[model samples]
Target: MYLLGLGLVLSLLKYLEVGPVAAWSWWWVLSPFAITALWWAWADATGYTKRKAMEKMDQRKQDRINKHKEALGIQPRKPR
Candidate 1:
């Protein structure tokens, strides 16, 4: 909704032949959408959006510790 209103205002300014205001306003309008889309794409590629990916990493680390404890015949400590 904000984007739509900004685009409308920019268009109106362009139609009115307003000099630098139109260009500056349009730049402000476009930069955020462009930056956010890029960030979302990067995050998607890196698996940052998935809880399962984080859980899997934690489980792998826990398994390594558990294996070391079992080899030493030591009981695992409970989480505080």
Candidate 2:
């Protein structure tokens, strides 16, 4: 909500030419978006994204299956 207000203020400033904000300088005003994109890319590279979360869940499931097999005197299948 604060971002929306800031964007609206920046847009108004740019449209009215009431400040030092030049039309071309509006690109500078979009730095927040670029920063957010960079953060998302870094998160993905660091395994902090949804795929890593799902992989962790799958690993827990496999562990449970192996434990169950051991309790039943059955050997768990090896991964291909």
Best by TM-score: 2
Candidate 1 has a TM-score of 0.37
Clashing pairs in 2: none
Instruction: Tell me the spans in candidate 1 whose CA falls farther than 4 Å from its real position.
Output: 1-23, 52-80
TM-score of each: 0.37, 0.45
- Which digits, one per residue and each the tens of the lDDT, describe model 1 over residues 10-58? 6667667587755665666456556667766877888877866788999
| Local error of candidate 2 at residue 60 (angstroms) | 0.2
Whose lDDT is greatest here?
2
lDDT of 2 by residue, 39-67 (tens): 77888888789888899999999999999
Candidate 1's error at 70, in angstroms? 29
Local distance difference test values of all predictions, in order: 0.72, 0.77
Model 2 residue runs over 4 Å out of place are 1-37, 41-48
